[model samples]
Target: MLEQHATELLRHTVEETFPLAREVMTLDARQYTCPERFAQEKQQIFSRVPLVLAASCELRKPGDFKTVEVAGIPVLLVRNREGTVHALLNACTHRGAAVASGCGSAARFTCPYHGWTFAQDGDLVGIASSTDFGAVDKTALAMKRFPVTERAGLIWVILDPDSSHDPADMLGGIDELVAGFGFAGWNHIESRTMHGPNWKLTFDAHLEFYHVPVLHRETFGPERSNRAFYFSQGPHQRVVAPRGRPGDTAKDDLYALGRLPAADEPFDPLLVGEWILFPGASINTFYLNGQRGVLLSIVLPGPDVGTSTTTQTFLAETPPDEVTRAAMEELCTFLARVVGDEDLPTSALQQKALATGLLEHVRFGQNEGGLQHFHRWLDDLLKADDAELAALLAEPCPQR
Candidate 1:
């Protein structure tokens, strides 16, 4: 399935043809500006759907853990001694205070506020002052645990503790291609968060490359392709440009495949593009000084309707040397500028305009199939109940 998509892209590139959707679509602008709608999205979509919180390599060893907040819910991801990953509510059972923050190795978390301790598996192992605090059932006071699954080198967690939905089902067939990347063995370099506009507004830019040439002219350059071909597997999508800047490493590598005498094997380089994990995450291929790398961007909605934070994690296929490390650092800095100065600033302005009630609808052109699919899925997910939502995701992905 992965190689077949690569072949399709190669064919499109050779034919100089990219398919477009049947018609343009319009979405209610208020979906991006209304507080009531944002609240529903938080509960229905953000809370219900499985979210990609970290790559498997981020917690490769037992006792490694990372903490992140999704839709205001603090989540702690940990790996136990037996090499199993678990997701727990970051709050301590004692007084709802967070037992951990940031990422590091720890056998147990001792809450700073009261000294309550929790094992990596969320077991309430120790109480600060057993006699003074009084006797209680430690079993009943265990940290809240959420359903979590690790697959295709990524870790997915459902914020809802009782959710019956399988996190793997949400990936659709995207895991096939992601597994090809062998991200489980990749080295985690660095991660940083950047503040942005509304979650939807910030994520909208990642679904389409229409504004790439104009918005990213200074960074990606004006010669870069403004057109892209979107392929979907369930709610996840890949933004593939049939053609792009001539000097782009991935593009050059892809075009070079056509020159080969016999292209029997799947050329891994051809699979390079932007792969978006639904709700809010994207993995974009990159090469630093000839070393393969990917930028995994996860966007989570903030406390209010008009704010979001994107955590960008850079990973390399192997440990980076000094030269490769320098290149990776340079690339990250450049991307920060491209997204912070260009993409997000534009989205923020759009949010401001939409908030004024001047525009009732936002139009997505036929070429913007990715955005159309995303908005449609979001609407459906928002309307679905627990059973309906599971049934919706369980349905097979539509064939392109």
Candidate 2:
């Protein structure tokens, strides 16, 4: 059972607080970098749960389709004539050849190796030599399909047919948390993908603001202070740091560098809000004056252990003008570079050490309460017997 105090605190923070307080803490890195644990995590995290497979933006119109690889399974996502999004196994039933090549508009997909075709809805439509086969049941040979659902502008897929789980239930407290940000009206402006040492390692680097004063001194150091940082945890974990006053010493350098616009009005008081959604999504909010924008990052497991991909989406209330858009792009690019150039190397190095038995376990601190909560959830899932796991999957998300 979830502790009563933790559950209450989560409900209040996610529902009531706009900029909540921060608690300093740390998480043991050993669990993530360990090879034996990584194998267990694959079955627990990737196979047992539904994951975001594609974005709705990729299949915005009928006949549009996109192909993606999910944990080594080739997936084809298509928008049928009725406009519903469907996910299908990409293999042709004839000889398991992939029916489609790249993202494009297609009423139907035809296998090039042999002449087999399937409709956008996964109906087997053709066979190269029907006469050669003696009354083969075409309906029985239709391409396989996977369960898919769309929410918050992204498409989610369940790989295991026998696994009983509800996507909404798995989303936990994120629905209310996202609704609180008024994101329904926001438009998707851009998306970028980056290769990382490990998805969880990259997430760990972003889960706390403790690194800002030290690791990000060259970039955000002048505009932010360690004392201004605050942390909160619930179903979602958040760390916030307000920009210092205009005339503070830290402000002079940031202003002189022309990175931040001169404070024409009082600081909006909400400078930065970083939220870590359970499982593997991170949402960030940035406030300059009264202008605000949100960045959402989703990390997914790749084909094997030690590899993963991070997909980021930038969104805003209004479509940005060239200048504003450029700034936003630059901001995301800089952050991506920091992760790729700095964090990835360290994480990879740690993975190597862990593989060689150099590290056994990692510890978490009080401020890193969010990390602790996340690991606890992981451990719970891993340790759960089959019966307990099923019960967890069936339970409804806690009410706000």
Best by lDDT: 1
lDDT of 2 by residue, 62-86 (tens): 9999886655678899999998988
* lDDT score at residue 126, model 2, on the 0-100 scale: 90
Q: Considering summed lDDT, which 10 consecutive residues are worst modelled in model 2?
A: 250-259
Model 1 residue 22 CA deviation in Å: 1.2
Report clashes for each candidate as comma-separated counts.
Answer: 0, 15
Candidate of highest TM-score: 1
RMSD of each predicted structure: 1.9, 7.3
TM-scores, in order shown? 0.95, 0.75
- Model 1 agreement with the true structure over 1-400: per-residue lDDT tens digits: 6556667877888887889988999899999989999999988988788899999999989999999988788999999999999999999988899998999999998888999999999999999779999999998988999988888899988898877777777656567667878899999988888898899999999999899888888888898888887878878888887765476655226556664324665456556678888989999888766678899999999888999999999999899999889889988988888888888899999999999999999999988999999999898888888877766775657733
> What's model 2's overall lDDT?
0.63
